[model samples]
Target: MAKAKKKSPSSIARNKIARRNYDFIETLEAGLVLVGTEVKSLRQGQISFNDGYINFKDGEAWLVGIHIAPYDHAGHLQHDPDRSRKLLLHDHEIIKLQAKSEQKGLTVIPVSLYFSNGKIKLQIALAKGKNVHSRKEELKRRDIAKDTARQLAKY
Candidate 1:
């Protein structure tokens, strides 16, 4: 057999709530600013994204609420779990995201994080929070899709 292709260095930890809470509008890949211990923790997939989000302010993009667990081997320089992390993005992308975020009800949220070419990258999404009805509709649609897939497999 031919050798299997390796999976891309994708999504170490994903924010499961982000998908059900918002319609996936657009996704952008951005670099992360991490310290030594934090980077080590992330590489081991010891991070959380449930409440993380990107903030654009004063011409900078920051990732807030992402939690990188303290590296067990740290000797006294452990990083803070809730500290804000800077994100690296192109100037044009920043401008566009800034413009888009100004739209009513639109927000910037982090979808996932992963390693790319030995460096950590974040997947951020431009999203709008779903109201109760919208979330219900999404659940209904997902159930329908699941049923359809199951029926197709039976043939």
Candidate 2:
């Protein structure tokens, strides 16, 4: 009998900074073009979202600045940790994203990476950068909401 592969959780990683620093206008899910070693590394939870962003060129979307650590066992076949990976999206979605991203203060950012029905998918967002004041206010609002919820629960 052959051993079954270990089942992993759906979410691989999230860009928490992107959530905190940007106000999302819209979100979309897209697939990625990854190598075998990159997939293995992602399965092992060896990925980073540092300085990651979406870049559009020649009408195609690419994921840039993300890092997927090289698999230890891959030896000679290990992929580059800093390579830009292509994002797979439909023609209409690509055109829409490209048009929206061209607007001032609007940009596309990777929010989270997860697996859907055995295929890896990336959740991206059209977002505007938040100033420090807005970020502070957001934190304050969350704190108040939490306090209100606690008091209500005490009843």
Q: Per-prediction count of colliding residue pairs? A: 0, 0
Worst 10 residues of 1 by lDDT: 4-13
Residue 36 CA error for candidate 1 (Å)?
A: 0.7
TM-score of 1: 0.87
- Give the per-residue lDDT of model 2 (tens digit) for 1-155: 99988766399999999989999999999999999999999999999999999999998999999999999999898899999999999989999999999999999999999998799999999999999999999999999999999999999
Which lDDT values do the candidates have, in the order given?
Answer: 0.88, 0.96
Q: Which has the greatest lDDT? A: 2
Q: What are the clashing pairs of model 2? A: none
Write one digit per residue (lDDT tens) for candidate 1, span 22-52: 8767899999888999988877889877678
